[model samples]
Target: MANTPSAKKAARKIARRTLINKTRRSRVRTFLRKVEEAILSGDHEAARAAFKVAEPELARAAAKGVIHKNTASRKISRLSSRVKAVGAA
Candidate 1:
């Protein structure tokens, strides 16, 4: 029900932004899941590598407003800790 032309344009913009954000979110989740899977498998090298890949993706997601900054930091912190623990063990 976008009556105004501006509103209609905004709706279109929103739809496009939503699709891009969804894809970014999905990519971030996939990276995080890869880290988790590597951790669960007790593969230190793989876990470390996945963490390296996921950390930037999480940060980028935050920067793009797909996720909050603190949440991204917390996730990266926890995953890095877990990876370190695995290395130590």
Candidate 2:
């Protein structure tokens, strides 16, 4: 339905961006899941290690606009707190 050449180009760009964003989102989710799995397994050290990896991924995703800054910060805060609790246990 994009009749104008500019509109067609914009559509193509959007499609490409969508794919890239989806890939980024999936990678972020995978990292988060790894952290959650480590936490659920009750291995504080493993969870900390996973969190160290995931934290940067989440921050990168937010910086790239794949997710909101506040959302990423909230997730990092909660995960860090939980990881600390695991260590205290």
Residue-by-residue lDDT tens digits, candidate 1, 1-89: 99999999999999999999999999999999999999999999999999999999999999999999999999999999999999988
Residue 9 lDDT, candidate 1, scale 0-100: 100
Candidate 1 regions with alpha-carbon error over 4 angstroms: none
Please provide, for model 2 over 1-89, each residue's C-alpha lDDT reduced to its tens digit, 9 standing for 90 to 100: 99999999999999999999999999999999999999998999999999999999999999999999999999999999999988989
List TM-scores for all candidates, in order. Answer: 0.98, 0.98
* 16: Cα error in model 2, Å: 0.2
Question: After superposing candidate 2, which stretches have Cα over 4 Å from the reference?
Answer: none
List per-prediction Cα lDDT, in the order shown: 0.97, 0.97
